[model samples]
Target chain A: MALNIVVCVKNTPSSLSVELDPSGQPKTAGVLYAINPFDEYAVEEAVRIKEKNAGSTVTALALGPDADQTVLREAVSRGCDAGVLVTGTEVTGGDTLATSRVLAAAIRKLAAAQPVHLVLFGKSTNDSGAGSVGGQVAAWLDWPGVLSVKKIESIDEQAALLWRMMEDGIDKVKVGLPAAVCTVKEINEPRIPSLKGKMAAKKAVFTKWTASDLGLKPEDAGAPGSGARVARYTAPAKRGTGLRIAGGSAAQNAAQLVDTLIERKLI
Target chain B: MNPQGILVVALNQRGQASPATWELLGAGRALADAAKQPLFAVLPGGTAEQARELVERGADRVLWTAHPSLKEFNDEMHTQAVCAAAQQLSPARILLPGSVAGRSLACRLAVKLQAGLATDVSEFSPSGMVKRGAFGGNLTAEVEFKSPIQVMTVQAMAFPPAARQAGRAGEAAELAFAPAAARTEVISFSAEEAGEIDLGGAERIVSGGRGVGGPDGFKAVRDLAHALGAAVGASRAAVDSGWIPYRHQVGLTGRTVRPKLYVACGISGQIQHLAGMSNAANIVAINTDPECPMMQQATISVAADIFEFIPLVVAEIKKRKGVPVAA
Candidate 1:
């Protein structure tokens, strides 16, 4: 049986150069956005799986504003067979719960046409880094979810063997197929986009789905349905200016550091 | 359900409550006190001793479950057990430690309860607001819950563990619930080869970056750490280069450490790396490039070759400590 894999991607500010307005909201007018770094790994893993499974296809999906199409295009250029952009004003400023609900709805719609064998996500996004959506999506779909997966040992029609990198150790787990897998950066080295792939991506027609298109009412999506809200923003407190220690040689510097540590009783 | 009290899901490893659990309790106590609500703690698959310890540590009421299926850290079972307790207790706020397992459980619980969740939170206000870093720590956002039930995962070391009272006692109740069959099963767990050093709890740390050159270059770093009795840490660059394991990595995508003294050897601090250790009490940077961000942010900047400097530092420490130097 041909496998259907869906890779979720997010478009975030390319750099940490965010400018907060007076209300502490990020002013994203001039900031450039790119595919989240972790999602690159997800796309790569999906593409590799497709390559291994000759009849399989990889679909990259993103839920955001219209600009998110750029991320979908990037995913297609990297290796995804197709691109999907799920957009709506309600999708903006949604918390992980709302976002997962919307994405789950979209995935369910897609699964109706063709059953999805595997769902993949970056361990977390660079912006939120909450790393909650994958598990929540899995719950909505009633499938098992695994986070921080470093390696996919094997996968077949029945189940998948995975190695998840934990804080103190690695867990080897076997989850029945039709499961959600969140990938870590250590999983694989992502391939660069080829010219032929870029050409295909440029001409690719993205399947666009709005909240209504996904059968989600305004109250069931976006901030209205979000469980949490960012009430305010503040810059982290600054640290004290450092004391520069100068010495004639490396040994002298080392001696000075030792003295300072001893004086402060930090050692 | 009319939520009324604050609930803390005590995280346990091998039946012992994790240090992060106590930290969450400390935060929960404050929130409960300010709200004038009862502070309750739930221990999934925990022992009687662990439950008693939590009560002494400020939990007004302790709810524990030792379900047979919950012998280990199974997300589904743990989540089900905790949710069952929450559903019965009707907690207005649920707090968890922001560990790997904690976050996963918090997410699943949020989905089950339809509660608002904020993970990796550093602070919580009595008014139901949470402060957490976003956009790779470049920005901080204060979050609020829209749902009646609020869920949050506190960052490790963000709050000090609650102190145990000598005679303080609280009621301990057994939580009875049957867990659903888990779709995933853990085959085995293999601990990392790294030594037993809790980076989050360490007072002093010595971290190396890619500039350490190679895997063998970590020798000097390990030596310095050994002399100081400190934990060893690495930048994402070093970990990604395969010079060291991810367990030692200190960065946005890795462990966040707030040691009293952080010594950076041959590390040109990236923003992601700095986010992990910038909260340290004092930072020392030793690198060739003086203009690097790590140098600028360090409390003490030493512009020298770490290869040459670490040995002398180790020797000086050993000499000061009255240890004989090898010829």
Candidate 2:
């Protein structure tokens, strides 16, 4: 079967090295953006599935500000057939529910044209690291969702066998088609984009979707319709000042460390 | 039942009431007490034995249902069960563990209910505010639910497990929901080696990173872990390098853990890595880099090579515990 897959990627800071202001909000100054590391695995997995099953198509779906296009381009460079950027204030700055609703709406719209057999997501976004949008989207779409997916054992029009990775073990799952899945690092090694692919991505144009385009109310995307709202941001508690041990030898340091632990009853 | 009662999803692992469930009960107990509302535990997939355990721990009442479909965790079945329980009980707030399954299920339940949800919540203020990690715990986002029902996945280990009352009495009822066929089937389960400490329940953890060099370097970490009765954790770097298995990886990309003590050996902390274990009661960073983020964040920073220092510390801990040591 020629499956149609939608891989959602998040555009996050290239590195988590950004500084938090005193109020604990991340400072945007000097921040560089790139495709989230985990999403690369999802895009790679989708691309791989597309390659094996000829005539299949992979659509890179993103929801954020205009900066999201960079992530989509990267996805295209990695073999995604097309891209869709869901942006604008009415569809941005949402918590998991809002985000999931918007993504599910976008998927619903895409499925209207061509039935989407599967939706793929990374383990988590580096920024929020909530690790739930994939399943939440599945919920909104009324589709079965599997998280911590390590492998796609097999997929056909009717069903897909997936390996769900848990802390202690792996559970093999057989899910009905048109399911949403979140991929983990153990799935596959993501490939680097070739020059030709990059050139193609440079010239590529992404289809944009918003609340209205997806036939959704403005309240369905952001703070207005969000179940959870950030009341405020606070700096994390400070750790007690460190006690540095750089004394003479390994034995001396070890002795001192043990003594401290004993005195504090930490051991 | 009051409209504002706190409903806890008391989950059973291998048909037993584990610490994770008890922890939810403990937090739920406090929340219910503060609100002066009854505490309810919803056992979506467990027997009466586990339901009794929930009452002994903290629940004032237990809503238990043990359908054959729930014997194994299928997302649709669990969600349907939970949604059914929520619809009937109508809890003001619902809490679940912030574990992998817990988070996944919470996400879906919130969508199904169209409720506000906070994941990895560390604290719930009496005035009805939720504090959770955002930006990988670099910042704390205080969340408020706009919806009528609030749902959250409380951070595991953030609260002490509720103490069991030997003969506490509580009400128990079976939840009735129209059963539907599950959309997923569990074919098989292949678990890691038995006897390895499950990181979610581990009280202490000793972790390694790229600085550990290779597979052999993990032995030092494991030795120290053995001495301290701690679980072994690895950063994504070490796991990706094949020095340790993915199960041991503790970071944003892996498991989020909140142990009593987290010891980092040869691991220069990445923000994503710190996101997983930053909530530990104490952190000790043993690395040569005095300026690394891990060292800066550690309660105790040791400036020394892990290879040379780990053995001495291991021997000292062993000596203190009256265990045999070469030195």
Candidate 3:
């Protein structure tokens, strides 16, 4: 039986641009854009799932402005069968709740066309690291979802066994069929796209849809639909002024370090 | 009306709840009492018995959905059930222990609910700001969510486990649910069962890194830990290089610990390594690098070769504790 899988992909600024301007809030501009690295793991997992099941198709679904296609194209190159761009001004500045609702509506439409068997997302977005969208999407679509999956335990038509990375060790959990899963970087190495795949993506058309297209109200697609707000973004605290030890043998350095730790009551 | 309840999602395998679930419930009780909210536990299985044990601990209610298909953790199905319960109950806050499954589930739920989420939170003030490790655990970050429903995953060992208090009995609420068919299925799962207890719950940990040299080097570290009655730990580098089993690795790629004492032997502190144990009550370092970052973070830093220092330190500790030291 042919199965359809959708991987939610997003492009985010590679790293936060931090600056101090009197106030603690960092200057947020001048950030570079790249495919959310963890999402690449999701795309790779989706492609691998399709490969194993045989007769399965993988679609990369993204919600962003025009520039976001950079990640979608990257996914296509990695072996996604097609891409969907749910884009519009309506979704601008939407928080995770709104974002999930919009994506869930889009998935609903896609499901109508091909019957989506599985949904995948990265564990968290770099910008916010909120890591909520996948779970919210499962709720929006009323499906079972799992997050931070480090290893795919098993996959069959009936269910999927997975190992989730925790603060301590891995937790073995099994999910029944038609589940949604979020991937973390520890899961797998994302494949680099071939030249042929790149060319194919360039020619492939992204199915662009707006909130109206998904029968969602405008308010339900943007900030008003969001569950949380970002009051401000700030830089992380500075490290302790680094201490340089004078020239010494390894033993000497170790002794000095120990002395310092003892003074600090660290050891 | 305490409309805002404390919600916890319990993870089970086949039908038994993992030990972490109890730890979470213990934490949940504290948060619930603080917030003046009821505590509800959600567990997935074919029967409510999977979560019955929580009632004896402090859970006011156990919302369960028993389905043959829901026996395993299908994220989609689990999320659906938990979200349904959350929506129905409208909890003001959700507490998930910062375990692998907890972090994953919490992140997904935050996105699903469009709520604010903080991961690996070591300290959370009543105010929204949370203290989390940043820059490889060399520093801390204060994260505040602007959302009404705050979702947090507490780091393991960050808070002491709460003793059981007299609370209402746990009531199991069966749900109308089913697990989504997963694209992948578990073919098999094989884990290396460590002969020793899990390090996450250890009171003291003695960790070695690449600087320890080779397999033989670890024997000394192990002997020291045994002498100290502490668990053994390893850095990611040691595990990746096959110097030690992954179960022994301690760092961002490994386990996070907040033991009473942590001793690093022959390991130069990497940002990732510190992230795992930065919260320990006291840290001791034994490395040749006087300028090594770990030395700066460690309260007790020793500048010596492990081969040379191990015998002396072990002998001293043994002498003080009135134990025999290996010659």
Candidate 4:
């Protein structure tokens, strides 16, 4: 059986170059936005699954400002079958729960149109790094789910075989049709899109929706609906003085290094 | 449905609770104690008799759902069971130790419950707060939760274990779960050869970075670790350059370690490398560059070359331990 897959992705600032404005919120001014790095893995995995199965269709979905269509197009370039953007100001300030609710609602709508065999997500976003969104989405949909999937062993029309990494080793797991799977970077090497693919993505018209589109109330999809929230944000403490050993040969350097370690009783 | 409120998933391997589960008991107990909640442990295995052991180990209640399919972790089934219980009790929060399994399940559960998740937290503040690394551990971001039913996955060693009581008896609730057969199966798993202990659980770790030239350079590191009865760790640079196996790498892309004592030799501490070992009780750095970031963070900084100091350090440890250095 051919599979239908949906990848939930986000557009985030490239790095920690974020600052809080007067309100002490993340400063978005002039910060460049790109596809969440981890989500790329999700897209890549979906495409790979589709390629392996031959008849699978992969849709890349994002929930953010309408401008995020640029990021959606990027997923298309990487071989997604379609692109979707769930946008609205009410969707803002959402924690993972709210985020998952919106995505889950959109997923439900999409599933009603065509069967979705699997839902994919990155392990976590660079901004939140909470790694909770995918799990929450799965719960909202009442679907069996897996996270930190490092490998996909088999994917037929009806069931999927995969592995989850553990402290001791990896465990093999099988999920029947219509399951959700989240992956870490270790899962697979995400492929870069080709120029031809990028051209195709640029021309593709992405579908747009909002909370109303998914039949969600405002309170059901943002901070008000989330189960957890950030209390504050702080900078990391500065590490010790950037100390460097003075002029010395490799042997001399080794000597000094050991002396320091010994003095600190480190070795 | 078990009435004992919250279900704490015990960290088990090959059908035994990892010692970390007891530590989780402390976290679980604190939450339960605060919320006036009751705590239960979910252990998957084939033994019913072993259920009492968890109670003895401080579980207020124990639930064992065992099957042959449960022999190896079937996350789908296990997660479903945990969620099934959560749905029944509706605990204010689901607490899991920030181990690999905990992170995986916590995220999956969040999606299921449409709840919020906090991962790898060193300390959790009940004031709706979560602290985690940012900029590769170069900074920490304090996060606030707007959600009521918070989900936190904490590091194993972040909190001390609850005081071990000799015989604190609690109810053991055996669960009936039919493990869903998994499609992917573990063919075989071979632990890294035990010349040194696993970095994750090592009491002492000696790590090296780019300064360790090549594979041959690891000899000094190995010798030092051997003398000190420690595990060996490497920075991403060393691993990427093929100086060490990726398994032995310690950094953002590698294993995060919390050893009692961490000795960094000739390593220029990058944020990524520091994230893996900053939690060590004692950090000692040996480097020629006094300005090296690792040195500044080192509780003790030795400005010397590792080659010169390693041999003597090895000899000193061997002499102190009265163990002859193996040729």
Best by TM-score: 1
Chain B TM-scores of the candidates: 0.94, 0.95, 0.82, 0.89
Q: Residue A132 in candidate 1 has what lDDT? A: 90
Q: What is the C-alpha RMSD of each candidate to the true structure, in Å?
A: 1.7, 1.9, 5.5, 3.9
Q: After superposition, how far is residue B271 of candidate 1 from its true place, in Å?
A: 1.5
Model 4 Cα lDDT, one tens digit per residue, B1-327: 322345567756676766677777777777677667787777765366666766776667677766665565555555766776565556666777677667767866766655567777777666546687654554566766544466677776766676666667787776766545554344445444646476766778999899988998899999888877798999988987888876677866677788878889888988668867887877878777877788888776677767777786676566556778566
By TM-score, rank the candidates, best first. 1, 2, 4, 3
Residue-level lDDT tens digits of model 1 in B1-327:
589889999977655668888888898888888989999999998877788889999998988988877776778888889988897788988998877788778888888888898998987776778898887777788998889888888887788889998668798889988877997888888886657567877889999998899988899999999999988999998998999977788887777777889999989989999878887888999999999999988899999888888889999999998999886
Return the number of clashes found in candidate 1: 0
**What is the Cα-based lDDT of residue A181 in candidate 4?**
87
On lDDT, the leading prediction is: 2
DockQ computed for model 1 against the true two-chain complex using alpha carbons: 0.75
Model 3 has how many clashing residue pairs? Answer: 54
- The segments of candidate 4 whose C-alpha lies over 4 angstroms from its true place after superposition are A22-24, A52-55, A242-267, B1-7, B30-40, B46-53, B67-69, B83-90, B111-114, B126-128, B138-148, B176-198, B218-223, B242-249, B304-312
Estimate, for each residue in B63-157, the C-alpha lDDT of model 3 and write its tens digit: 77776655655554556678887877788778776665566567567766657666777776666567765434544557656666777777767
TM-score of chain B of 4: 0.89
lDDT of 3 by residue, A25-129 (tens): 434467567777668889999888888887999999999998788778889998999998988899867866789889999999998987787899987665555
- Per-prediction DockQ comes to 0.75, 0.72, 0.21, 0.39
DockQ of predicted candidate 2: 0.72
Comparing 2 with 4 on DockQ, the higher-scoring candidate is 2
